[model samples]
Target: MRRRLSFFACLGVAVERVMTDNGGCYRSREFNAALAAEGVRHIYTRPYSPWQNGKVERMNRTLALEWQYGRAWDSEAGKASTLPAFIEHYNWGRPHSACGGAAAHAAHRRRKQPFGTQQLVIHAFRKSSISM
Candidate 1:
């Protein structure tokens, strides 16, 4: 979380709040401390309510369907190696309805003031691996 916070800070993005489900990791003292140290407010979604965090849920589903399960990989490393490229394409190539049919990066580029008055929200989830 610290690393991610630093990354966004370097990009001139000020993280204001984070919203996550009732996950154990998110409830940990260390995680809460990190957010508190950074002056970021942490919010928790109602239990069993996925719709409260629909955007991230949709993103995770898209990632799984479009990249993770799109093809068969010979090895885990091979699949891992392709993630960055897929993320790059997802952000810069594919069109999104929220962006009014423009790619996320392109939409941000069109903005007169990028990151201005925008509150960055980080949603952390446990890492899961696919069993081959």
Candidate 2:
């Protein structure tokens, strides 16, 4: 939760609400009181409906692919220490197909809008025909 707060702060967005699963920590009265004090709305997803937070779920899949399956971390401590570094690389270095194959870091620098995979495939075909 603290990490989430820091992330939102870095992004310059005030979290007006929080959506969470029925985790014990989130369901605690203290946690709800805190949210109330901060005037941030709290939304709990229906059980078995994790897709309510699709973006986060997708990112978890990406993390599993990029780090959990691909990397070798022998111990918990090692994985914990490397997590921040991995997140930085994922946010800044990784190329997202949804973002037009451009590195996330480069997206902020470039002015052009992203082209989806279908657009890329069509563009490639057009280029080949023009060359022929």
- Per-model lDDT: 0.79, 0.61
Query: Which window of ten consecutive residues has the lowest lDDT sum in model 2?
Result: 117-126
For candidate 1, lDDT tens digit of each residue in 46-123? 999999999878778887898889998898889888977876787679998988999876777787567655554453
- Report, for all candidates in order, the number of backbone clashes: 0, 0
* Model 2 accuracy (lDDT, Cα): 0.61
**Candidate 1 overall lDDT versus native:** 0.79
Q: Please provide, for model 2 over 6-93, each residue's C-alpha lDDT reduced to its tens digit, 9 standing for 90 to 100.
A: 4555655566777776767778898788778777788887989978866556666776677656677787576667766876776678
What C-alpha lDDT, on a 0 to 100 scale, does residue 98 get in candidate 1? 88
TM-score for each predicted model, relative to the true structure: 0.86, 0.65
In candidate 1 the C-alpha lDDT for residue 50 amounts to: 91
| Segments in model 1 whose C-alpha atoms lie over 4 Å from true places | 119-123, 129-132
